[model samples]
Target: MAEEQPFALQRHEKLMERLRLHGAVRVRELADALGVSELTIRRDIAALADRGLLTRVHGGATLPTVLDETPARRRRASAPAFTIGMVVPSLDFYWPQVVNGARSAAAAHGVHIQLRGSSYDQAEDRRQILRLVESGQVQGLLLAPSLEGPGVAELIDWIGGLSVPAVFVEREPPRWTPTPRPLEWVRSDHALGLELAVRHLHAFGHRRIGLVLSKGSPTSAHLAAGWHRACEELDLPDDFVVRESVALNVPGHREIIGGIVDRCRRDRITALVVHSDPDAISVAQYLTEQGASIPDDMALVSYDDEVAHLAHPALTAVRPPKTTVGRTAVDMMMARLLEGRNRPVQRTLVLPELVIRASSITSSWQRETPPAG
Candidate 1:
């Protein structure tokens, strides 16, 4: 006879289908349907909850509420008594985790989050902000910007005029330009995290290290500065620094990795540090296809840790304290909402940790040599 399916997988499949069909399901009912104890069902639900897949209620679970897509003007005009707005470039993997943290914190304070995405378009970002502010829908904002091109200056100008209290997340305002008076920010220390990645490679005896950047953005600038700091600290020559910028898409990533490898070949770079896990995995695949073995011919490291472990050769990455950033951003926003908008401005900076994995190791060429007799 065939063996019974694993309890975890069985429960996950049933939970997903139930959530899709019924929008929510109680723990006891789910357990009875799957022929498992309620305790078993609770564990299954907890696993999903950890990933922000479903919301756990007192006795069961429910689907996350879909964000209202009403026009910003309309939303602002009929804004709730206490509503917070989250302005992000797009609702991708990164933003969602931050949003989850914000939502959880907001729920505790009896507040709601009005999340808006800009599709990485600066104009749209301005429009969304204006709608929220003019309609008076949001009392505060948690902004994670995508200041990619010429429009950033304009976007910043608009945000400065919004009057409501705001906190910038993920990316900080530019250095040369003075931000509109009294703008506050909460961000991961990209410089510190990237420095950690580079130092990890250097400790493994990799002198020639390459970097992949997302060009034309302030975020990339911080990452580049960190890479340079590491190289400078180690006294590596300028030629050892190979930088390549690519768009944030599958095709763009493919092209960027190809460019990185090309730079590696010309410069004899034996290691690479990327800005994100997705890019690290892409570069690893490209290197493997080109007959280079990981931790043998080259070493690799990256910034974000979420996708690292899932790669073929688990990646060594600098894990940002994303949950903390989320929690902090929400806390700041809530303070603005509760304590009146005139409260003293605050800034929170979160440091990330380095996680070592199989993808990065001492370069084979750097392995210890036997002592002579």
Candidate 2:
């Protein structure tokens, strides 16, 4: 009991800190972070709830709210009242988890989400958004519109001017200058995600590391920022970077990847962090075809976990909390609809998770994970 007291106290402290930061805490996440069992985390949550520290919700605990934020209580006694229109650049890849997460939260709150798939084009995003708005079916919006190009500033203003409340899913408002209105957003801290990857490789005795970014991705800028900042902090070289789409279908992809490989050899880079799985997998396939080995020849860490495990060597990856981002956006939407502008503007930043696997680790690496889940 005495030995357990200190550990329990530490766990309680962490739970409170996370709740204060993100407004909620998940049981599975807490267990993983603390290296404890889910049952143990539940018990800790119970103890905390008994102290009026938090309100227990399904699979998690949240800040105590008078309306009872738990889904068990909020589960539609009747049909939903409000409908939220959701638009994403792609229905596939990174957006699905986020959409599913929104669906989960919306179901709990007895709300409907009208989803529309758009491309990365700002004009297409506007067209989709306008169609949803012009239909007069939605009272709120959960948008993942293109945050690039010259027209983005005007788009941000237009979204803000809409009669309904809006939440940005995995997107942020303009950063170059302030918008006419304070926007609400939730996104994975991709910068910090890259930092995690860089630091992880550094600890594994990798002195020189490179970063390869997918061209034209909004997330790429954040990843690059993180790579530079982390490298600077670690005193690692920041010279080796490739800012191009090196995925399989891209024109001259083989030559593009070949150049990257040749550069790594010339620079003696021992580790590389590639943004997104397709690019990472391309590099992996090319390396294998050339008879080089992963982690042995060049340790590889991919940015997105989507399909990273499906790669030949099973890449270690930075998994952005996509579901959490979506859930949080909906939660904020609920707050906005309920309290209106009385509630403070929220621009939440959720961190990404690093899933260790075969590609980024050798036998001697301490924090190793199973090759397949």
Candidate 3:
């Protein structure tokens, strides 16, 4: 037997369908058609109004005129009139949120996002960006650059010469090198996020902290800076910080965690902080498999709070204000398009906050017990 739909959802669905077909609908008519009371229809209208899906009129409801097109149409028209190329290192879990934020922000201003993944490979990324620029189809670009790419300076020069605005996300260009033209950029304050995570761990009495990072990215650089800053503020020695870089893949992650565990055993590290939630979860799970007790033998903290909830022991993570970063990027792009090119270069750095959870706690074990000779 088929399950019946809930009354509220059914009412909302019917009302939306009616509005879509007829462009507007009266409460009484909607109630009669859906076999619900007029009062029920009014409630439904109010709910939709609260969601900004529709506007409530004197006796009826109307479609939201602000919506440029139906959801279906919007997905199909992902790349609208002006193509905005989005270049990222990979389409991992975190990238999706950043991309979603960009897409939503672009939609508000009637722009579109055409996405391309680089898989952290510099050569392929440069080729893709050059192709898009040479094609003359893309008006602007939102790039997340790899830190260790070859010929990066040459590529940046090429991009600058394209005569289109570019916004770097999650990474910043080198400060030492001057660009022929100024570039607008937007990024999450990873340093701030790491500081928050480290502070939380320190508050829980974790002194010997280890960081797991991915190498060759500006994001990693900022995180490293924050980790160093926290250690300085806490009056801890540089030796208290241990770091290992790994590629961002399944097998790579396994090897990295194995290395981290080995380091923990050798260094007597009590607390660990990872750069991403997925990595933290993986490390925790791997530690459990090895018969190590969490929050007792070791404490864990990480960044990107979404996947934290899904971990076996919900992870303590730093949540970046990604939505704000997205919206700000759009605002910057709009200003570039509408205003003259000679305006001052704009940069927006969104701050992140630490969300404490079960994964990290006060360290119970004071020292690693050694085997008797």
Candidate 4:
């Protein structure tokens, strides 16, 4: 049998499912259904409410009436002052949160978002962007393009020539060249997120921390920079840095992870900071299989918060402020479209938060140990 999930996470999953099936959930009913106390149910409702995931009524929670519309359906709403075309690398995982935030912000500001999903390939990015541009159905663009591809310079040049206003989401332009016009951007401070993860492990009495980056992600460079800087500032050992990212989906991932684990063991590294949650979870599984104790022998922190809470032992993770990045991109687009040349180039960097969990602490330690009796 599978191990039971943590109370908070279990409740959250059930609560979301209940809401989906019943359209709303009553606190007392949910408590009785889940075999938990009414107070616990109430707390869950309040937490979900605070996150804007649900609407809390006097005695129950209901879905947000108009705001809960699907992305495609939402786009069909009555034409507004502006229609913004958005293209992101992936619709799954991290990009969804950013899209939701953008949609919410657009709704609030009486704008419409025409979204398109693209793959990691630069050609796909260009194709999707060109489709949006050719459609001529949108007045502005919000893009999270693949910046590392060989065609990056050409892509930049094309975007520079677009007639409509454009704002990059979770991406920044190269600083080496002056473009025809100023570019606007809104991105999460991924570097700070990495720093936060390193600092968190350090606080747990880990001196030598290893870093495993995802070579495929643009965020890896920023994360590596932060990892090095934090080690220097905190006076911690930094020789265990892995310059290459371990791709979790590849066929030889297991062997690669085994090598990484062996390196950690040889270096006596007590903790690790991984680029994304999936990679971190893979490392955890490998460690468990190798007879190493999590948190006791090795503490772990994942960079992205997407599914870290679902990991065995529930990983501590750095959550990028995705929603804010999306919302801010829309806000910047609005300013640029409305103010025209009067508005200066807008650049915003939102901070990420560290979500602490059982994985970050030593398994042998208690949260509140009793004094000598």
Candidate 5:
């Protein structure tokens, strides 16, 4: 489950989006759309009204600037200014929140988001992107293309020469010389997220820690870099990094996990920081079957927060700010459309948040707020 603060923030984002899209939002409609009670929506409206972000009407709330405007003017103001095409690999797991955030921001700004699902293949990425671009319906594009392939450079160049503005969401172009039109991107700083995990383990009195990065992931390289830097900074024992994955899908994963557990026992490694939640839980479950106690025998921290809270001991995790990245991608595209060539090329990195849980802490230890950086 999401925390109250993040949940309320998401509600406010949706509320403002509704207000912007329709110039006003009825309480009943908002309750249904947001899956909250009318009373909760009213409270939200009241809170927004106090902040002067919206004005409470008879049964709804209107944009702060729209309450006094004429009907015709309001309609003109609320009309969609742009339609953006988006292509992403999957609508499940990590990308759904991103799409939702982009949709919320698009609605809030009177922009439309037309999404297309594609398989995570370079060929499919090209097909989906070219289909949207050649259709000429979209004023801009928000794309998350497959970044690892022989033709990646060609793909980037093709996208760079497009007629409409394009923003890469959660993807970066591989190292290349500057084209006449450089691509812009917004992604989470996973490297720093890995550092957060190591620092948290260090503060929890772990001196000999291990890192297990997921194989065949774009994010693994970043996590490995972070692991190396954090180990150097913390002056912890080294030579314990495992780059390959032990996911259930891998053949002979039991042996792989057993070797990992045996290495920890030999090295006296008390804690581990893993790239993702599924892999972390696999290791944790294996350890449990071996009669090991979490935190007592082996504490664990996972990088992705997708299913961390669902773990048996409730894994501590680094939660990437995926929604914020999505919202920012749209906002950046809007700025590019408005500013045209005057806008500087941007490569923005948003930070991930660390959420502490039982797996990484002792019973007597209270959860401390994570560092802002």
Candidate 6:
């Protein structure tokens, strides 16, 4: 016989087993089998649902998707049940997980998602949204557009005036003006994510922490807000802040990353929070070139989890729940279709988690020793 584990762990394990065997599990049945109350089973299901491990239905939980089900079968079965058009900023990096999560939820609810890719440019965002709107086949939309650019106001008004139900994914409404039409939104709490990173570095004995933000990222403002707030709350110095976009492939990019590395070295900054994985990778490389060992010499934490694991040391990162965000967006759209204007506008902020790795485990800072030519 195997040794017993904690009750919650045991219950969750058993639930997974049941889902694998039956494709779904009812709360009453699970409660009876586990000798627990139905309420306990419901709570467990809710927790599992939040983690994207399972999808909660009226009276039971189901496996998120049929792993063996082919796309052809899924499309054939779901055949325009409730067509939803989705426009996202990019098909590569970060957004794919969001799309997959939405697809899973659509499959569960017997709906279909029509996906379109766009760039960060306002014009491009509008083009994608218009393409979806003109399709005539879609009754709803999920959009992640350039909410910060000059065209944002016009775009928001256009979306608000749309005849179909729409939901914003990974974007928030402008607080500056009252929306022409009520809109629903779902996004990761990037501000909270920054605070999580700061706390993690602080826990590891890093005091003089620094932050580097990608210039045009939508989440940068929220992250900076969190960073500053955390610094104030924790009584840590917050003087070292860099706000620039570094394109490693561009000419003169080396100097920008080199400058950042030099500043950190001179300021005795023990830890740094870098937004997005690509820039973080560049900084890590530049720092290594300066003879600074990651974690040992300077602790590093990347904000976006998308490709952070690919870094040399496998970065500690704040991971937005991309999959869950996608899945919930679809769910919100479904609710809007069913409830119409009867349901209150939903604005959800999903919490992000810090994935600890080798890059942020040092107990003390080790100053960089520049490499000899």
Choose the strongest candidate by lDDT: 2
What are the lDDT scores of the predictions, listed in order? 0.72, 0.86, 0.73, 0.82, 0.83, 0.84
Query: What is candidate 3's lDDT per residue for 75-156, written digit by digit as tens?
Result: 3322343568888887876777888888987786567787888867667777778777777767788887665657788766
Candidate 3: pairs in clash = none
**lDDT of candidate 4 over 131-169, digit per residue (tens):** 988997787999988889577888887787787768999
lDDT string for model 6 (305-352, tens) is 888999888999999999999999999997666445545688999999
Those runs of model 1 whose alpha carbons end farther than 4 Å from true positions after fitting are: 1-81, 175-181, 216-218, 238-259, 340-342, 363-373
- In lDDT terms, how accurate is model 6? 0.84
Instruction: State the displacement of the C-alpha of residue 164, model 1, in Å, after optimal TM-score superposition.
Output: 1.6
Instruction: Tell me which residue pairs clash in candidate 2.
Output: none
When summed lDDT is taken over every stretch of 10 residues in candidate 3, the lowest stretch is: 71-80
Pitting candidate 3 against candidate 6, the one with the higher lDDT is: 6
lDDT of 2 by residue, 270-342 (tens): 9999987999999999999999988888999999899999997999999999999989999888766644453
Candidates' TM-scores? 0.69, 0.79, 0.69, 0.76, 0.76, 0.75
C-alpha-based local distance difference test score of model 3: 0.73
Off by over 4 Å in 4: 1-78, 243-248, 364-373
Check candidate 1 and list the clashing pairs: 76-135
Q: What is the Å distance of residue 121 in model 4 from its true position? A: 2.4
